[model samples]
Target: MRFIRTRTAKATAATLVTVPLALGGLAAQSHAQDASPSPSGTFGPGCSALAQKANTAKDKVVEAAAAYPQLSHLVSATVRAKLSGALDGKPNVTIFAPNDQAFQQASASQLASLLSNQGQLKKVLTYHIVAKQITPDALAKGSFTTVEGGKLTTSGSGTEFKVNGKAKIVCGNIKAANATIYVIDAVLRPPS
Candidate 1:
């Protein structure tokens, strides 16, 4: 069974095509319409780091993520899930990528278990990715759907949006060639 949020038209063109194996992974906002929503409030520690490349960027989603040392584990997880094409090739994706330290805090056994199963890994990773672009303004209210077919509820305003009522959007509104990225401090787990 699949779970989806009560929302409208978050997915448009992409269906996560896979010729070999289906993989998953995790964007920021940069556009006249993709506003930051918060100018004075501070978010997570990585905000400054993300801001440095938040705008005036030309790299693709995955490529841009790979540039951030903090997102190394997320990039690796995406590669492991064989989701490079979905993220790198597709457009208008929004990713709530968890930093490396988030994974580092997971139980060694849990990490090992996910790494061992591609299907399970895909579901977990996709839970963090939305099929459509999500701006900080849009995130100010309502729920959203993940490619994994799960519900991600957002509350709070500006740079304080939280995912699943737990994971905080530390760095957000980052624009990439094919996606928007929100760096979160926690990795969102899909319902069993």
Candidate 2:
């Protein structure tokens, strides 16, 4: 009788462990099923992947810039030159990048003026960034406050997204390990 009781207790413990393991696997599968498909029609290609690669936002931005040449030029030299000191050690910065055509539209003289005015340049660039990774789908037609103490109003539908009421997101959802980059057709400026 004693031996039978001990065997029953051991079997109960094993069954309890097995039940949780099966439930855990089912939960994981359910999560996978619920995950939205990537904007590019691919699976698992957003901030989740980026977060897995880099533990922090700043590190993710740096990793993305390093991987993409065009993006690197925008954040590292053109924007970084004006914002180096202020942006150093800052975390969770989301930079909206304007393509080369956007830069081409702005006269060299205008850029030069911005470079000379560090305060204005910082304000403008920082306005493009938020302290958190805001995915394309998360954005809606509303005003969002920036890290620079300015508010940007976003509008439009689906992939036709615009920021600060002017700049359009040409290519959206380029995720970095820690940051999300949206390529826009115009640079964002604060309200004057």
Q: What clash count does candidate 1 reach?
A: 11
Error of 1 at 42 (Å): 11
lDDT of 1 at 134: 75
What is the per-residue lDDT of model 1 for residues 80-134, given as tens digits with 9 covering 90 to 100?
A: 9999888887778889899888899899999999988999999999999888977
lDDT of 1 at 184: 88
TM-score of 1: 0.74
lDDT of 2 at 145: 78
Candidate 2: regions farther than 4 A off: 1-59, 76-88
Leading candidate by TM-score: 1
Q: Lowest-scoring 10 consecutive residues by lDDT in candidate 1?
A: 19-28
